[model samples]
Target: MNQRLNRTAVVKRAAELADEIGFEQLTFTRLGRALGIAPPGVYRHVSDLDDLRRAISHNSARNVAVVLSSACAGLSGHQALSALAQALRDWAAMHPAQYAALQIAPDPNDTEGQEAAHELISVFASTLRSYQLEGNDLIDAIRLIRSTLHGFITLELSEGFKLERPIDLTFERIIIALDAMLRGWAV
Candidate 1:
């Protein structure tokens, strides 16, 4: 007998699988087996591995945006930046696998995927205005901060730190570096 499946439930399950097993290893076969369905059965929800990846990335990005938006609320300038940076770092630390999946760039043609990706960056860009940023400088600053936080978290999660210094200290140092950069931001 064939089992019935809910589309929403399947996508949620597939998303969980993506985080647990990593995006690259997520296949319809694996998801179907886990869900007690045939491999082809999953085709009703996900067309292929790429579609599955897009779904996973979209979910992860949306979750990150929720966290970031909450953190930056009612704050401005350095305070906003600090709140956002810490929030992003904390989210990434807690959900390393999900965070990694969220880093995948979405295809511009994929409307859903693009909107998800936009939410993530838009939150940062909006918080950036609290710094009195504008034009190319604003764009550049946002890129710098995002890259810094993302790179640090990615490296830390991968055990890339080689020094005897505490990881906490390294993160603090990063915040300080960003603060200094922002202080001279308009120059």
Candidate 2:
């Protein structure tokens, strides 16, 4: 807290605060208070709240890419898919606020944000490569995987599931079904 707060440090702290509180509650005033600085002092690092949100979003995307890449290392196909899916679910569960940040689409004009977003997509696309998918097929497969995983994780995070059956069993069954679908993917 003694060192001069740089943009990177501010963004990192903002992400941590977002995880502690919720992203919606994150603001320059809150961040400044956390950093023991005035709101104007925070402006030296981030221009405003939207900028901070973008920074958080970019960081979230990069973090997810790193996690997914690590999870799928030395693995491929169904093995990779299972690891990647579980890693994503674990990440979402652990960092609900940052995970929410990841759900926001980056502004098209923001190069860094776009690149970070693409990095996440590339991780999923690479995992699906073993299925021999390419072009639109590859894109669709990526969407399917993301949508399925995101849907379940978001629902679980919101406590939307009211079933008596165990969620873990349901998640495992989902992975199995996805594996089968990937194996049988045509076109």
| Deviating ranges (above 4 Å) for candidate 1 | 1-4
Supply the global lDDT for candidate 2.
0.91
**Cα lDDT tens digits for candidate 2, 54-171:** 8999999999999999999989988999999999999998999999999889889999999999999999988888898989988888989999999999999999999999999999
Cα lDDT, model 2, residue 154: 92
- Give the Cα error of residue 108 in candidate 2, in Å: 2.0
**Which pairs in model 1 have colliding backbones?**
none
Alpha carbon lDDT of each predicted model: 0.81, 0.91
Candidate 2 segments whose C-alpha is farther than 4 A from its true place: none
| Steric clash pairs (candidate 2) | none
- Across residues 30-117, which tens digit of lDDT does each residue of candidate 1 receive? 9988888889988887777777767778888898899999999998777888888889888877776678778788887889889998
